[model samples]
Structure formats: C-alpha cells, structure tokens
Target: MESLGIQHFGAFVLACIALALTPGLDTFYILARSGREGRTVGMAAVLGINAGCIVHTLAAVLGISAILMTSALAFAALKYLGAAYLVWVGLRMLLARQSARQPTVTRGRGLSAAFRQGMLTNVLNPKVALFFLAFLPQFVSMQAPHPQWGLAVLGVSFIGVGMLWSMVLAMLGGQVHRLLDARPHLGQWMDRACGTVLLGFGIRLAMQRQQ
Candidate 1:
C-alpha cells in the first residue's frame, strides 16, 4: 500500500464502510429485490452492482470519467437515461398484476434479470462516474508511483466493503419476504412501496446538477 502511495489506509476503509452502511439507491435496490424475489436474486443484484462499480473504477483509471465531469451534454444524457430506466422499472413494479396463484421466490431468469437491472441502474448514473473521479483520489498520494493502480485498489476496496453490506441487506430482506410470504397482499404492498421510492429516486437523480 505504501509503495502505491496510498495514504490513510485505515481511514479509507472506515470511510468506505460508512458509505456502504449508509442507505442509498444500491441499498434500496438490493432490498427491493430480496423482499420481492429471494435471497439468491438479491445476491445476484449485489454482484451486478459491484460489477458496475468495477466499470466505473476502470473508467476512472482510463480517464473516461473525466468526460462526464467536463461535458455537460454527456453527463445529462447519461443522467436522463438512468432516470428513465429507473422510472420504467418503478412503473412496472407499481403496475404489476398480482397472480391468482401463490407467489414464490423467483429463480432462473429472474436472477439474471435482477442482475441486469442492478448493473444498468449503477452504470447509467453519471453521478457515480463523477463520484469515482472525485472521491477515490482523496486517499491516493499525488506523488504515487502508480496513481492509476492506487485508484483501482481503493475502488476495489470500497466495492468489497459495499458488497459485504449489500449481502447483509439481501439476507434481511429475504427474511422479511419469508415472514410476509403467507400474506400475499402484504408483499404486493411492499412492492408498491419500493416502487414508489424508486420513482422518487429517479426524479431526484434527474433534477440533480453537477457539482
């Protein structure tokens, strides 16, 4: 770590842990999936989100994230796309038709769909790219031997912490789902509630300005 010019390693870990614990879109998304589907699908969403973070980390290393930071058009385009996608997902959930059959935990294609949704949600948000560009450098020494590698390490560490937290959320959500499984209407209510939050998050993302 010293060779790579990373400073305040302990502090960085703590910050990452704190951020992971904080409720955010990722947390909501994972919980929604777990509560609606099952733990397996929720874990899939967690992996997808981490994969998206990896993409952002690579963009930071390659300086692609700089375009989002510098170009308003590019940023807005991604922001709108992300907002639209979120709204679409939210609407689907809100408008979902309850089946006559008893609802069970989703599997198979559902897992893949959850993963894709998580990845797209993370990837389309331009703020996340900007965040990596802005946040990761704080712990990296400007005089580091390999600044790019330093960023990668820090990014991976952050994602690792986040994954751990996300897994816990998935488990908790799953337990909630299990408890509410017998009450199908309650699950529907949970779906609607989650959908409403997602819609609000989308609108907030659309209204946010670059800082």
Candidate 2:
C-alpha cells in the first residue's frame, strides 16, 4: 500500500469523523427510536447501520458499485426505489405526529430485528452504495502502489468511524430519553423533529445525482 503523509491522513480522518457526525437517515432513525424506545433499540439501529456499511464496503471492493454506477437504468431504478422508501417513511412519521403523543415501543425479535432494520436501511439505499464507490476511493492512491489495499484501509476506516459515532449518538439518545421521559410533550416534539429530519434526508438522497 502507498504511504500517506501525516497531513493527508489527519485531514482524511477529520473528514470521515465529520461525515459520521452529520445526521443522515441512520443517525436520525437511531436517535429518534432510541429516544422513544430506549438504548437497546438505538444500539440495534446502530448495529443495523454498520451492517449496511459492511455491504457497501463489500460492494465497492467487488466492483458491483461500478456496474450500478455505469448503468443508467439500474441507477435510476434503484434511486427511485430508495426515494420512494424515504418518502414513505417520512409520510409515516408525519401521519404519526398526532398519534405519537405518547411513547410506545414496538416488540422486536430482539436486537437481531433492530440490527436487520439498520442493515436493510443502509443496504437498500442505492445512494449509500454509490457513495462508497465514489467517496471512499478518492482517498486511495492507485498510482502509488497497492490500490486495493489503500481502498481497503479507507473503507475500513469509514466503517469504524461510523460505528464509533453511532454508538455515541445512541448513548446520547438514551440520555435524552431519560431527561425527557417525564415531559411527554417535549418527547413528542423531539419525535417530530427527528421524523422531519429523516424525511428531509430521504428526499435529498432520492434527488441525488448519480454522477
């Protein structure tokens, strides 16, 4: 693998960390659900999100992302599906606004269900796959030496950053839930906020250009 300069590596790490902190679908879903259901569900969402990241990593490594990227029909079809899913999720949240006056928990098959939800959310979103294909490769230096190794390192780093940041968010959600548990009105508002944010992200993802 090619050696990176300290400055380049530092910059890359910072950028990745920032990306992780940004509120995306995974983040919003985890935080919102965590606040409502408790840490267990939040953690489940985190696991699911990471699982999705793994899929992205594998797709990028195997060159499946390239195929999706180059094919217009495939890209369009995936994009619409992802967009529709987001819209659907958003609509669900909006409709639930009045009904969400009180926090209610949905029984799952346990953490496995949460993890699956997280993974599916990430995996099903074609934009995420495309993101890995486009974003992670930029840091790799193919001309330097072992391009594959470099890509591997970058991909792994992205996943690690995502995992760590998500755990932190999950913890925060738990804390916020505790703080707001006594205040149902505040909790309701938080749910609305999270739902709105998620809806916006879904829309943005749908409208994203393949290029």
**Where is model 2 poorest over a 10-residue stretch in terms of lDDT?**
99-108
The TM-score leader among the candidates is 1
Summarize candidate 1's per-residue lDDT along 111-136 as a digit string, tens digits.
89889989999999999999999999
Root mean square deviation (Cα) for candidate 2: 3.3
Q: Tens digits of per-residue lDDT for model 2 on 1-211?
A: 3463122566678889899988767887788767766788789889888888888898897789898889988887877777676666566655564543543333234477567767776887887888889887777765655566666677888888888989888888888778776776676667556557767877887787777
Write down the TM-score for model 2. Answer: 0.81
RMSD of 1: 1.8
Q: How close to the true structure is residue 6 of candidate 2, measured as C-alpha lDDT?
A: 20
Candidate 1, residue 108: lDDT: 35
lDDT of 1 at 130: 94
